[model samples]
Target: DASWISNGNVNGLGWSLKDQMGSEYFGLRACNRSLSALHAEMEGLLWATSCMRDMRITSVRFETDCSDLVDMTTNPMEWPTFATEIEMYQRLQEDFEDVSLSHILRSRNGRADALAKKARNRGYIFSHIDQTRSYGGVLRRIGSYIST
Candidate 1:
């Protein structure tokens, strides 16, 4: 999910990885300059995908509450505004053996929505990754915060 400050040029992007049992194993929050909410969502997905690849996570399913993002990825030619982002997303998918994006109800995505809002309200400019499950002894990595 993504959040935009009303009077500023900053946008917050957040994403979380959950297991089949609905347990959140990983999550991220970051701030960036996005042209629109759709763009912010795309940025969040890109960051999350890169992180998954870094961790050697090959098969995954990404869920978002943004239906437009799903549509944009499914039919890239119809969304010219997000052509570049869609292209980048396709390139990232190549790293994984199987990957898919699906839309879920907003009510089912509270955690990610709240994280995005918190990052936007706090003006956080760095990426923070929280790994609940230990991945080869790598627990968590707190990025250096940059003040605006």
Candidate 2:
């Protein structure tokens, strides 16, 4: 998973799973009660960190539309509630030779948003569609939303 987008309060988190070529291969959405947006964001990041470790991805760039999250993860700022996540992210960063985090405009995060919306509308927390045979159309749609 490379990026995440959260649906409304009732819904959950949507994440984009991409391959080495930067082509989206799967979309994962999950719900957990008693968690705020911040928690979901952290969870998504944590999930991505774990996946990267499992896939042995040592060099990676993570993009998020949430500027606050980017700041928190990239800076020394911390919140009492987010302490755990902050530490986890920091530790994860340490394990990598090169890991970068950046903030992107929501408009440029259309793929993640689209996946989140699909999850919300369908009331499904998880869905994975192999794009090897039909990624062209999705990529085209995503191209318009990602700014150069």
Give candidate 1's error at residue 27 in angstroms: 3.2
Q: Each prediction's TM-score against the native?
A: 0.82, 0.68
Residue 15: error of model 2 in Å?
3.1
Clashes of 1: 0
In model 2, the runs with Cα more than 4 Å from the true position are 1-11, 17-22, 124-148
Highest TM-score: give the candidate number.
Answer: 1
The 0-to-1 C-alpha lDDT of every candidate, in the order given, reads 0.77, 0.60
Ten-residue stretch with the least lDDT total in model 1: 139-148
Give a tens-digit lDDT track for model 2, residues 1-148. Answer: 1222344433444555566654654445544432566666677677666656655778888788878778777664556668878998888888788988788898887776666556555554553433332354445223212111
Residue-pair clashes per prediction, in order, are 0, 1
- C-alpha RMSD by candidate, in order: 4.5, 7.1
Query: In candidate 1, what are the lDDT values of residues 39-145, reduced to their tens digit?
Result: 78888888888878987889999999999989999999999988888899999999999999999999998888887877777665766666454456554443322
What are the runs in model 1 whose C-alpha is more than 4 Å off?
20-23, 133-148
